[model samples]
Target: MSTEPTASGHEAASPAVDPPAWLQRIKSNYCRVCGSPLKLLKPDGEREWRHVCGSCGYVDYHNPKLVVGCIVEHEGKILLCRRAIEPCRGLWTLPAGFMELNESTAAGAARETWEEANAAVKVLAPYAHWDIPVIGQAYILFRAALAPPYTFSSGSESLEVALFAPESIPFDQLAFSSVSITLRLYLEDLRAGTFRLHHGVIDKRPGSQPNDPGAFVVRDHMALELGGASATAAGPGVQEQ
Candidate 1:
Protein backbone atom coordinates (compact mmCIF):
# COMPACT_ATOMS: atom_id res chain seq x y z
CA MET A 1 0.00 0.00 0.00
CA SER A 2 1.22 3.50 -0.79
CA THR A 3 1.71 5.83 2.16
CA GLU A 4 2.05 9.57 2.53
CA PRO A 5 3.28 11.94 5.20
CA THR A 6 0.52 13.52 7.22
CA ALA A 7 0.45 17.00 8.70
CA SER A 8 2.39 15.70 11.67
CA GLY A 9 5.04 14.54 9.23
CA HIS A 10 4.39 10.91 10.04
CA GLU A 11 3.86 8.49 7.21
CA ALA A 12 0.22 7.46 7.20
CA ALA A 13 -1.11 4.39 5.50
CA SER A 14 -3.84 4.49 2.91
CA PRO A 15 -7.46 4.50 4.01
CA ALA A 16 -8.44 1.10 5.26
CA VAL A 17 -11.02 -1.03 3.48
CA ASP A 18 -12.52 -1.87 6.85
CA PRO A 19 -13.21 0.41 9.74
CA PRO A 20 -10.38 0.30 12.22
CA ALA A 21 -10.60 -2.37 14.88
CA TRP A 22 -10.70 0.32 17.57
CA LEU A 23 -13.78 1.91 16.02
CA GLN A 24 -15.58 -1.41 15.86
CA ARG A 25 -14.66 -2.15 19.44
CA ILE A 26 -15.83 1.27 20.59
CA LYS A 27 -19.11 1.01 18.68
CA SER A 28 -19.88 -2.44 19.98
CA ASN A 29 -19.36 -1.73 23.64
CA TYR A 30 -21.34 1.36 24.49
CA CYS A 31 -24.42 3.52 24.05
CA ARG A 32 -23.92 7.22 23.54
CA VAL A 33 -27.38 8.43 24.63
CA CYS A 34 -27.45 6.53 27.87
CA GLY A 35 -24.51 5.75 30.08
CA SER A 36 -24.89 2.00 29.72
CA PRO A 37 -23.26 -0.99 28.19
CA LEU A 38 -24.63 -2.11 24.88
CA LYS A 39 -25.51 -5.53 23.57
CA LEU A 40 -26.00 -6.71 20.02
CA LEU A 41 -29.58 -7.56 19.11
CA LYS A 42 -31.31 -8.13 15.82
CA PRO A 43 -34.68 -6.47 15.88
CA ASP A 44 -37.63 -8.12 14.23
CA GLY A 45 -37.35 -8.21 10.40
CA GLU A 46 -33.76 -7.02 10.55
CA ARG A 47 -30.75 -9.12 9.67
CA GLU A 48 -28.02 -6.81 10.99
CA TRP A 49 -26.88 -6.43 14.56
CA ARG A 50 -27.82 -3.24 16.32
CA HIS A 51 -26.37 -1.91 19.55
CA VAL A 52 -29.08 -1.92 22.15
CA CYS A 53 -28.85 -0.27 25.52
CA GLY A 54 -30.03 -2.58 28.28
CA SER A 55 -30.90 0.30 30.59
CA CYS A 56 -33.02 2.52 28.36
CA GLY A 57 -33.68 0.09 25.53
CA TYR A 58 -32.27 2.67 23.18
CA VAL A 59 -31.16 1.38 19.81
CA ASP A 60 -27.95 3.04 18.76
CA TYR A 61 -28.12 3.22 15.02
CA HIS A 62 -24.96 4.22 13.27
CA ASN A 63 -25.54 6.26 10.15
CA PRO A 64 -23.27 7.71 7.54
CA LYS A 65 -22.03 11.25 8.17
CA LEU A 66 -22.82 13.99 5.69
CA VAL A 67 -19.86 15.76 4.09
CA VAL A 68 -20.32 18.83 1.89
CA GLY A 69 -17.96 20.53 -0.54
CA CYS A 70 -17.78 22.63 -3.67
CA ILE A 71 -15.86 22.88 -6.89
CA VAL A 72 -15.23 26.63 -7.02
CA GLU A 73 -14.26 27.92 -10.44
CA HIS A 74 -12.49 31.20 -11.21
CA GLU A 75 -11.12 32.39 -14.50
CA GLY A 76 -11.18 28.87 -15.93
CA LYS A 77 -9.25 27.46 -12.95
CA ILE A 78 -10.45 25.32 -10.08
CA LEU A 79 -9.69 25.99 -6.41
CA LEU A 80 -7.93 23.51 -4.16
CA CYS A 81 -6.63 23.59 -0.60
CA ARG A 82 -3.58 21.93 0.81
CA ARG A 83 -4.80 20.30 4.00
CA ALA A 84 -3.13 21.32 7.24
CA ILE A 85 -4.88 18.65 9.23
CA GLU A 86 -4.42 14.91 9.29
CA PRO A 87 -5.97 11.99 7.32
CA CYS A 88 -4.38 13.32 4.12
CA ARG A 89 -2.44 16.35 5.15
CA GLY A 90 -0.28 18.25 2.64
CA LEU A 91 -2.35 16.81 -0.19
CA TRP A 92 -4.73 18.91 -2.24
CA THR A 93 -8.53 18.74 -2.18
CA LEU A 94 -11.70 20.69 -2.86
CA PRO A 95 -12.93 22.85 -0.01
CA ALA A 96 -15.02 20.45 2.08
CA GLY A 97 -15.96 19.41 5.58
CA PHE A 98 -18.61 17.65 7.62
CA MET A 99 -22.05 19.23 7.78
CA GLU A 100 -23.10 21.13 10.87
CA LEU A 101 -26.50 21.48 12.51
CA ASN A 102 -29.28 23.63 11.08
CA GLU A 103 -27.66 24.16 7.69
CA SER A 104 -28.65 23.02 4.23
CA THR A 105 -26.20 20.94 2.23
CA ALA A 106 -25.56 23.76 -0.19
CA ALA A 107 -25.02 26.16 2.67
CA GLY A 108 -22.59 23.77 4.27
CA ALA A 109 -20.75 23.47 0.96
CA ALA A 110 -20.38 27.20 0.64
CA ARG A 111 -19.33 27.60 4.25
CA GLU A 112 -16.71 24.94 3.89
CA THR A 113 -15.37 26.66 0.82
CA TRP A 114 -14.91 29.89 2.68
CA GLU A 115 -13.62 28.22 5.81
CA GLU A 116 -11.02 26.19 3.96
CA ALA A 117 -10.14 28.46 1.08
CA ASN A 118 -11.22 31.89 2.31
CA ALA A 119 -13.02 32.27 -0.99
CA ALA A 120 -16.61 33.36 -1.35
CA VAL A 121 -18.62 31.64 -4.02
CA LYS A 122 -22.07 31.55 -5.53
CA VAL A 123 -23.22 28.02 -4.92
CA LEU A 124 -24.70 26.52 -8.08
CA ALA A 125 -26.03 23.10 -9.08
CA PRO A 126 -25.43 19.83 -7.35
CA TYR A 127 -22.43 18.31 -9.02
CA ALA A 128 -22.06 14.95 -7.32
CA HIS A 129 -23.37 12.73 -4.53
CA TRP A 130 -21.51 9.73 -3.21
CA ASP A 131 -22.29 7.04 -0.66
CA ILE A 132 -19.22 5.67 1.04
CA PRO A 133 -20.64 2.93 3.21
CA VAL A 134 -17.39 1.57 4.48
CA ILE A 135 -16.30 4.83 6.07
CA GLY A 136 -19.87 5.82 6.87
CA GLN A 137 -19.94 9.07 4.90
CA ALA A 138 -22.06 10.64 2.19
CA TYR A 139 -20.50 13.43 0.17
CA ILE A 140 -22.58 16.18 -1.46
CA LEU A 141 -20.57 18.21 -3.94
CA PHE A 142 -21.70 21.33 -5.75
CA ARG A 143 -20.53 23.36 -8.69
CA ALA A 144 -19.93 26.95 -7.71
CA ALA A 145 -18.47 30.08 -9.23
CA LEU A 146 -16.20 32.50 -7.47
CA ALA A 147 -18.15 35.51 -6.31
CA PRO A 148 -16.93 39.05 -6.96
CA PRO A 149 -13.34 40.05 -6.11
CA TYR A 150 -12.11 36.47 -6.68
CA THR A 151 -9.67 36.62 -3.79
CA PHE A 152 -8.59 33.70 -1.55
CA SER A 153 -6.30 32.81 1.32
CA SER A 154 -5.59 29.67 3.28
CA GLY A 155 -7.71 29.13 6.34
CA SER A 156 -6.63 27.37 9.53
CA GLU A 157 -7.54 24.02 8.05
CA SER A 158 -5.37 24.61 5.01
CA LEU A 159 -1.69 25.21 4.59
CA GLU A 160 -2.18 26.94 1.26
CA VAL A 161 -4.88 27.70 -1.26
CA ALA A 162 -4.46 27.97 -5.01
CA LEU A 163 -6.15 27.51 -8.34
CA PHE A 164 -5.17 25.10 -11.05
CA ALA A 165 -6.30 24.64 -14.58
CA PRO A 166 -8.20 21.44 -15.30
CA GLU A 167 -5.24 19.99 -17.18
CA SER A 168 -2.89 20.88 -14.36
CA ILE A 169 -4.82 19.28 -11.48
CA PRO A 170 -2.61 16.91 -9.53
CA PHE A 171 -4.71 13.79 -9.51
CA ASP A 172 -2.03 11.68 -7.82
CA GLN A 173 -1.74 14.08 -4.88
CA LEU A 174 -5.45 14.51 -4.21
CA ALA A 175 -6.49 14.06 -0.58
CA PHE A 176 -9.40 11.73 -1.31
CA SER A 177 -10.88 9.60 -4.05
CA SER A 178 -14.16 11.50 -3.90
CA VAL A 179 -12.35 14.77 -4.64
CA SER A 180 -10.44 13.26 -7.53
CA ILE A 181 -13.53 11.70 -9.04
CA THR A 182 -15.54 14.87 -8.65
CA LEU A 183 -12.86 16.96 -10.36
CA ARG A 184 -12.53 14.47 -13.19
CA LEU A 185 -16.29 14.39 -13.75
CA TYR A 186 -16.50 18.17 -13.56
CA LEU A 187 -13.76 18.59 -16.11
CA GLU A 188 -15.38 16.05 -18.41
CA ASP A 189 -18.70 17.85 -18.13
CA LEU A 190 -17.00 21.20 -18.69
CA ARG A 191 -15.62 19.91 -21.99
CA ALA A 192 -19.06 18.57 -22.94
CA GLY A 193 -20.72 21.83 -21.81
CA THR A 194 -23.37 19.98 -19.88
CA PHE A 195 -23.06 19.63 -16.12
CA ARG A 196 -25.33 16.92 -14.77
CA LEU A 197 -25.83 15.41 -11.35
CA HIS A 198 -23.74 12.31 -10.69
CA HIS A 199 -24.73 9.64 -8.20
CA GLY A 200 -22.54 6.74 -7.15
CA VAL A 201 -21.37 4.49 -4.32
CA ILE A 202 -17.85 3.98 -3.03
CA ASP A 203 -17.53 0.76 -1.05
CA LYS A 204 -14.17 0.34 0.65
CA ARG A 205 -15.21 -2.38 3.02
CA PRO A 206 -13.19 -5.50 3.44
CA GLY A 207 -13.75 -8.37 0.97
CA SER A 208 -13.88 -5.77 -1.80
CA GLN A 209 -11.13 -5.31 -4.31
CA PRO A 210 -9.99 -1.69 -4.58
CA ASN A 211 -9.32 -0.20 -7.98
CA ASP A 212 -6.42 1.90 -6.68
CA PRO A 213 -3.81 1.85 -3.96
CA GLY A 214 -6.20 3.71 -1.71
CA ALA A 215 -9.03 1.28 -0.81
CA PHE A 216 -11.71 3.35 -2.61
CA VAL A 217 -13.90 1.46 -5.05
CA VAL A 218 -16.27 3.56 -7.13
CA ARG A 219 -19.38 1.81 -8.40
CA ASP A 220 -23.00 2.33 -9.46
CA HIS A 221 -22.17 5.45 -11.43
CA MET A 222 -24.88 7.12 -13.54
CA ALA A 223 -26.40 10.49 -14.26
CA LEU A 224 -29.52 11.33 -12.31
CA GLU A 225 -32.65 13.24 -13.30
CA LEU A 226 -32.64 16.75 -11.86
CA GLY A 227 -36.00 16.69 -10.12
CA GLY A 228 -36.29 20.22 -8.78
CA ALA A 229 -36.01 23.72 -10.15
CA SER A 230 -32.58 25.12 -10.84
CA ALA A 231 -30.51 26.32 -7.89
CA THR A 232 -30.25 30.01 -7.12
CA ALA A 233 -27.49 32.08 -5.54
CA ALA A 234 -27.74 33.01 -1.87
CA GLY A 235 -25.75 35.22 0.46
CA PRO A 236 -22.83 33.82 2.38
CA GLY A 237 -23.81 31.25 5.05
CA VAL A 238 -27.40 31.41 3.81
CA GLN A 239 -29.32 28.47 2.39
CA GLU A 240 -30.42 28.67 -1.21
CA GLN A 241 -33.74 27.60 -2.66
Candidate 2:
Protein backbone atom coordinates (compact mmCIF):
# COMPACT_ATOMS: atom_id res chain seq x y z
CA MET A 1 0.00 0.00 0.00
CA SER A 2 1.20 3.49 -0.83
CA THR A 3 1.37 5.69 2.24
CA GLU A 4 1.81 9.45 2.22
CA PRO A 5 2.93 11.42 5.21
CA THR A 6 0.12 13.52 6.64
CA ALA A 7 0.66 17.02 8.04
CA SER A 8 2.19 15.36 11.09
CA GLY A 9 4.59 13.54 8.75
CA HIS A 10 3.27 10.22 10.01
CA GLU A 11 2.70 7.71 7.27
CA ALA A 12 -0.95 6.72 6.96
CA ALA A 13 -1.92 3.56 5.12
CA SER A 14 -4.18 4.03 2.13
CA PRO A 15 -7.68 2.73 2.58
CA ALA A 16 -8.62 -0.54 0.92
CA VAL A 17 -11.79 -0.74 -1.16
CA ASP A 18 -13.94 -3.80 -0.62
CA PRO A 19 -15.74 -5.51 -3.50
CA PRO A 20 -18.27 -3.13 -5.10
CA ALA A 21 -20.91 -5.85 -5.01
CA TRP A 22 -20.68 -5.75 -1.24
CA LEU A 23 -21.37 -2.02 -1.39
CA GLN A 24 -24.51 -2.74 -3.36
CA ARG A 25 -25.58 -5.24 -0.74
CA ILE A 26 -24.95 -2.65 1.99
CA LYS A 27 -26.91 0.03 0.14
CA SER A 28 -29.89 -2.21 -0.52
CA ASN A 29 -30.12 -3.93 2.85
CA TYR A 30 -28.97 -1.29 5.33
CA CYS A 31 -30.42 2.15 5.91
CA ARG A 32 -27.74 4.80 5.45
CA VAL A 33 -28.64 6.46 8.75
CA CYS A 34 -29.57 3.82 11.29
CA GLY A 35 -28.29 0.72 9.51
CA SER A 36 -31.88 -0.55 9.57
CA PRO A 37 -33.68 -1.71 6.44
CA LEU A 38 -34.18 1.17 4.03
CA LYS A 39 -37.86 1.25 3.13
CA LEU A 40 -37.99 3.94 0.45
CA LEU A 41 -35.91 6.47 -1.45
CA LYS A 42 -37.32 8.72 -4.09
CA PRO A 43 -34.06 9.29 -5.89
CA ASP A 44 -31.03 7.46 -4.55
CA GLY A 45 -27.68 8.88 -5.59
CA GLU A 46 -26.22 7.06 -8.57
CA ARG A 47 -22.64 8.19 -8.14
CA GLU A 48 -22.70 7.59 -4.38
CA TRP A 49 -24.96 5.47 -2.16
CA ARG A 50 -27.04 7.55 0.24
CA HIS A 51 -30.20 6.86 2.21
CA VAL A 52 -31.60 9.27 4.79
CA CYS A 53 -33.75 7.54 7.38
CA GLY A 54 -36.40 9.54 9.23
CA SER A 55 -35.08 8.11 12.49
CA CYS A 56 -31.37 8.94 12.26
CA GLY A 57 -28.57 10.10 9.95
CA TYR A 58 -25.74 7.72 10.65
CA VAL A 59 -23.09 7.66 7.95
CA ASP A 60 -21.33 4.35 7.62
CA TYR A 61 -17.67 4.25 6.77
CA HIS A 62 -15.22 1.36 6.94
CA ASN A 63 -12.95 2.63 9.67
CA PRO A 64 -9.86 0.78 10.91
CA LYS A 65 -9.27 0.54 14.67
CA LEU A 66 -6.11 1.90 16.32
CA VAL A 67 -4.21 -0.15 18.93
CA VAL A 68 -1.02 0.43 20.96
CA GLY A 69 1.58 -1.51 23.00
CA CYS A 70 5.16 -1.31 24.21
CA ILE A 71 8.30 -3.48 24.05
CA VAL A 72 9.48 -2.94 27.61
CA GLU A 73 13.04 -4.01 28.41
CA HIS A 74 14.79 -4.18 31.75
CA GLU A 75 18.26 -5.44 32.62
CA GLY A 76 18.77 -7.04 29.21
CA LYS A 77 15.41 -8.78 29.45
CA ILE A 78 11.99 -8.14 27.89
CA LEU A 79 8.71 -8.30 29.79
CA LEU A 80 5.92 -10.74 28.90
CA CYS A 81 2.75 -11.88 30.59
CA ARG A 82 1.07 -15.26 30.42
CA ARG A 83 -2.59 -14.96 29.52
CA ALA A 84 -5.29 -16.53 31.69
CA ILE A 85 -8.07 -16.08 29.10
CA GLU A 86 -9.16 -18.10 26.11
CA PRO A 87 -7.73 -17.96 22.55
CA CYS A 88 -4.21 -18.53 23.92
CA ARG A 89 -4.49 -19.16 27.58
CA GLY A 90 -1.16 -20.07 29.23
CA LEU A 91 0.82 -18.33 26.46
CA TRP A 92 3.13 -15.33 26.84
CA THR A 93 2.69 -11.88 25.24
CA LEU A 94 3.73 -8.28 25.49
CA PRO A 95 1.60 -5.88 27.54
CA ALA A 96 -1.03 -4.17 25.37
CA GLY A 97 -4.70 -3.23 24.99
CA PHE A 98 -7.34 -1.22 23.09
CA MET A 99 -7.67 2.55 23.04
CA GLU A 100 -10.63 3.96 24.92
CA LEU A 101 -12.74 6.97 24.01
CA ASN A 102 -11.68 10.45 25.24
CA GLU A 103 -8.07 9.32 25.60
CA SER A 104 -4.97 9.77 23.47
CA THR A 105 -3.48 6.68 21.78
CA ALA A 106 -0.37 6.86 23.96
CA ALA A 107 -2.49 7.21 27.09
CA GLY A 108 -4.48 4.14 26.10
CA ALA A 109 -1.28 2.18 25.56
CA ALA A 110 -0.05 3.23 28.99
CA ARG A 111 -3.35 2.33 30.58
CA GLU A 112 -3.28 -1.12 29.02
CA THR A 113 0.25 -1.62 30.30
CA TRP A 114 -0.78 -0.59 33.79
CA GLU A 115 -3.84 -2.82 33.69
CA GLU A 116 -2.09 -5.89 32.29
CA ALA A 117 1.35 -5.66 33.83
CA ASN A 118 1.02 -3.20 36.69
CA ALA A 119 3.95 -1.24 35.28
CA ALA A 120 4.28 2.39 34.21
CA VAL A 121 5.85 3.34 30.90
CA LYS A 122 6.92 6.22 28.70
CA VAL A 123 5.67 6.28 25.12
CA LEU A 124 8.38 6.06 22.50
CA ALA A 125 8.21 6.88 18.84
CA PRO A 126 6.53 4.51 16.43
CA TYR A 127 8.30 1.18 16.01
CA ALA A 128 6.29 -1.37 14.02
CA HIS A 129 2.73 -1.52 12.76
CA TRP A 130 0.57 -3.90 10.74
CA ASP A 131 -3.01 -3.89 9.42
CA ILE A 132 -4.99 -6.97 10.40
CA PRO A 133 -8.59 -8.14 10.55
CA VAL A 134 -10.22 -10.00 13.43
CA ILE A 135 -13.58 -11.41 12.38
CA GLY A 136 -14.71 -8.07 10.84
CA GLN A 137 -12.83 -5.33 12.70
CA ALA A 138 -9.67 -3.90 11.13
CA TYR A 139 -6.82 -2.63 13.33
CA ILE A 140 -3.54 -0.68 13.41
CA LEU A 141 -0.55 -1.35 15.70
CA PHE A 142 2.17 0.81 17.27
CA ARG A 143 5.34 -0.28 19.11
CA ALA A 144 6.49 1.70 22.14
CA ALA A 145 9.03 1.57 24.99
CA LEU A 146 8.67 1.33 28.76
CA ALA A 147 10.45 3.20 31.53
CA PRO A 148 12.96 1.07 33.45
CA PRO A 149 13.11 -0.61 36.88
CA TYR A 150 9.40 -1.31 37.08
CA THR A 151 7.75 -4.29 38.78
CA PHE A 152 4.90 -6.21 37.17
CA SER A 153 1.87 -7.90 38.74
CA SER A 154 -0.63 -10.44 37.50
CA GLY A 155 -3.82 -8.87 36.12
CA SER A 156 -7.29 -10.31 35.60
CA GLU A 157 -6.27 -11.76 32.20
CA SER A 158 -2.69 -12.55 33.12
CA LEU A 159 -1.63 -15.77 34.81
CA GLU A 160 1.89 -14.49 35.46
CA VAL A 161 4.34 -11.77 34.39
CA ALA A 162 8.07 -12.07 34.00
CA LEU A 163 11.10 -10.82 32.09
CA PHE A 164 13.25 -12.97 29.81
CA ALA A 165 16.54 -12.36 28.08
CA PRO A 166 16.57 -12.33 24.31
CA GLU A 167 18.21 -15.74 24.06
CA SER A 168 15.71 -17.20 26.48
CA ILE A 169 12.47 -15.95 24.84
CA PRO A 170 9.96 -18.78 24.95
CA PHE A 171 8.90 -19.09 21.31
CA ASP A 172 6.68 -22.13 21.76
CA GLN A 173 4.93 -20.44 24.67
CA LEU A 174 3.99 -17.36 22.65
CA ALA A 175 0.23 -16.83 22.35
CA PHE A 176 0.19 -15.49 18.79
CA SER A 177 2.49 -15.48 15.79
CA SER A 178 2.41 -11.71 15.87
CA VAL A 179 3.82 -11.78 19.39
CA SER A 180 6.62 -14.06 18.31
CA ILE A 181 7.46 -11.88 15.33
CA THR A 182 7.41 -8.72 17.41
CA LEU A 183 9.86 -10.20 19.89
CA ARG A 184 12.11 -11.43 17.10
CA LEU A 185 12.13 -8.00 15.48
CA TYR A 186 12.82 -6.33 18.79
CA LEU A 187 15.75 -8.60 19.50
CA GLU A 188 17.13 -8.07 16.00
CA ASP A 189 16.95 -4.33 16.54
CA LEU A 190 18.59 -4.68 19.92
CA ARG A 191 21.51 -6.60 18.44
CA ALA A 192 21.97 -4.11 15.58
CA GLY A 193 21.37 -1.08 17.76
CA THR A 194 18.85 0.14 15.16
CA PHE A 195 15.07 0.13 14.97
CA ARG A 196 12.88 -0.10 11.88
CA LEU A 197 9.15 0.38 11.55
CA HIS A 198 7.29 -2.02 9.30
CA HIS A 199 3.70 -2.39 8.12
CA GLY A 200 1.83 -5.22 6.37
CA VAL A 201 -1.65 -6.56 5.83
CA ILE A 202 -3.09 -9.75 7.36
CA ASP A 203 -6.59 -10.87 6.35
CA LYS A 204 -8.51 -13.19 8.70
CA ARG A 205 -12.10 -13.11 7.52
CA PRO A 206 -14.22 -15.93 8.94
CA GLY A 207 -15.98 -18.63 7.00
CA SER A 208 -19.39 -17.64 5.64
CA GLN A 209 -22.54 -19.45 6.70
CA PRO A 210 -24.84 -20.26 3.81
CA ASN A 211 -27.34 -17.46 3.06
CA ASP A 212 -26.10 -15.32 5.90
CA PRO A 213 -24.51 -12.44 3.99
CA GLY A 214 -24.58 -9.91 6.79
CA ALA A 215 -23.27 -12.25 9.46
CA PHE A 216 -20.13 -10.75 10.91
CA VAL A 217 -18.27 -10.91 14.22
CA VAL A 218 -15.16 -9.38 15.79
CA ARG A 219 -12.78 -10.71 18.44
CA ASP A 220 -11.10 -7.97 20.45
CA HIS A 221 -8.58 -7.66 23.34
CA MET A 222 -6.05 -10.19 21.98
CA ALA A 223 -2.43 -9.33 22.63
CA LEU A 224 -1.58 -9.76 18.96
CA GLU A 225 -3.88 -6.88 18.03
CA LEU A 226 -2.46 -4.62 20.69
CA GLY A 227 -0.92 -2.14 18.28
CA GLY A 228 -2.31 -3.66 15.08
CA ALA A 229 -0.84 -7.15 14.63
CA SER A 230 -2.83 -10.19 13.60
CA ALA A 231 -3.30 -12.42 16.64
CA THR A 232 -4.54 -15.51 14.86
CA ALA A 233 -6.46 -16.86 11.87
CA ALA A 234 -10.19 -16.33 11.36
CA GLY A 235 -12.20 -19.49 11.75
CA PRO A 236 -15.64 -20.66 12.90
CA GLY A 237 -14.32 -20.30 16.43
CA VAL A 238 -12.03 -17.30 16.84
CA GLN A 239 -9.49 -17.80 19.61
CA GLU A 240 -6.16 -16.33 20.72
CA GLN A 241 -3.67 -18.64 19.04
Q: Per-residue lDDT for 14-110 in model 1, tens only? A: 2325443534564467777888998766667654456789998888877779999998877778899999998788899999999999999999999
Question: What lDDT tens digits, residue by residue, belong to model 2 across residues 31-123?
Answer: 555667543332343233344454564444444567666666565677788888866788888777667799987677778778888887766
Clashing pairs in 2: 33-58, 87-240, 140-228, 141-227, 141-228
TM-score of each: 0.78, 0.62
Model 1 lDDT on a 0 to 1 scale: 0.78
lDDT of every model, 2 decimals = 0.78, 0.57
- Backbone clashes per model, in order? 0, 5
Candidate 1 residue runs with Cα over 4 Å from true position = 1-28, 205-214, 224-241
Candidate 2 Cα outliers beyond 4 Å, as residue runs: 1-55, 60-62, 134-149, 204-241
- What's the CA error at residue 150 for candidate 2, in Å? 1.5
lDDT of 2 at 2: 46
